[model samples]
Target: MTEAIASEAASNPGMQMKYKIVFLGDQSVGKTSIILRFTSDSFDVKYQATIGIDFLTKTVYVDDKMVRLQLWDTAGQERFRSLIPSYINDSQVGVVCYDITSRQSFENVKSWVEQARQ
Candidate 1:
């Protein structure tokens, strides 16, 4: 896990900067999977939808300093949009992802980004 962190930092040093992270993307785009991988080092193949929002926190050691990431996994469904704005407040970083095989999902990432901006 530390190796993964090192490799990630090597590729994008910006992530090392302190951030309150939020994951935003279309449904079933592996946003939750990514968080679970980072947080729990485990993955499940079964698809389960998020209700409104899920929250997790992990502290990464960066150059003798502890950088904390408050990660929020928001629901990708339209019905959950009303619940998203609350999660966006105080967020310092946002990750938007979409599955490669889903063109519609990919196209809708813009709206998700826009919603976050609001």
Candidate 2:
């Protein structure tokens, strides 16, 4: 399911384009936190597992062009793995996050990449 968030128009006077960015990773790997940091510049210390999916939008200027990024935060639990392929198929960018302190999370990067590719 797609969740909509308020989006601001880009400062550039030309036509704006929308890009979909999806974040993927193992549970507790900070996927939501990273997107929150980039979109709101705030981080929550509390840990919360995301449900199926959560979405947010942020407008950014790239090369003096206005771009609207549709950020999709996905659940990392194995139970939700089946829902990821549809999101990946629709995304223009996929960010795979992992906990720096967890060796297991690091090792799972390949698996995440393969999922995103599929």
Candidate 3:
């Protein structure tokens, strides 16, 4: 999908490219918060668990060229865990998020990293 969209942006193929970045971690670990802050420059106090997968895109100039970042906000719920690998396989980057205050969240980072590595 990333390649397909980037290819479709044929107006300036050489001047522009796209990348997919997947966020992974345990529940309430700030994956969505980080994405929200980066994309919208705002944070929500109302906590909500991402169901399935949520996608957001942002474009920026890099080295005098256009770069479109396709951010994949994946649900941290166990039920959604099965759906992450396909996204990981297609992504160019993976971000493993964890809550600093929660030992379990921090401990789970290794597993999240392992999944991203796979």
Using lDDT, give the best candidate's number: 3
Clashes of each: 0, 0, 0
Go through the candidates in order and give the C-alpha RMSD of each one to the true structure: 5.9, 6.3, 4.9
- Alpha-carbon lDDT, every model: 0.82, 0.86, 0.87
- Our tally of clashes for model 2 stands at 0
Best by TM-score: 3
Q: Sort the predicted structures by lDDT, highest score first.
A: 3, 2, 1
| lDDT (10s digit) by residue, model 1, range 3-94 | 54455566665555446788999889999999999988999999999888998888878544456777899888989989888888888778
How do these models rank on TM-score, best leading?
3, 2, 1
Candidate 2 lDDT by residue in tens digits, 11-100: 335667688999999999999999999999999999999999999999877656667899999999999999999989978789999999
Clash pairs detected, candidate 1 = none
Give the per-residue lDDT of model 3 (tens digit) for 49-74. 99999999998665455788989999
User: Between the candidate structures 1 and 3, which one is better when assessed by lDDT?
Assistant: 3
> Residue 94 of model 1: what lDDT?
82
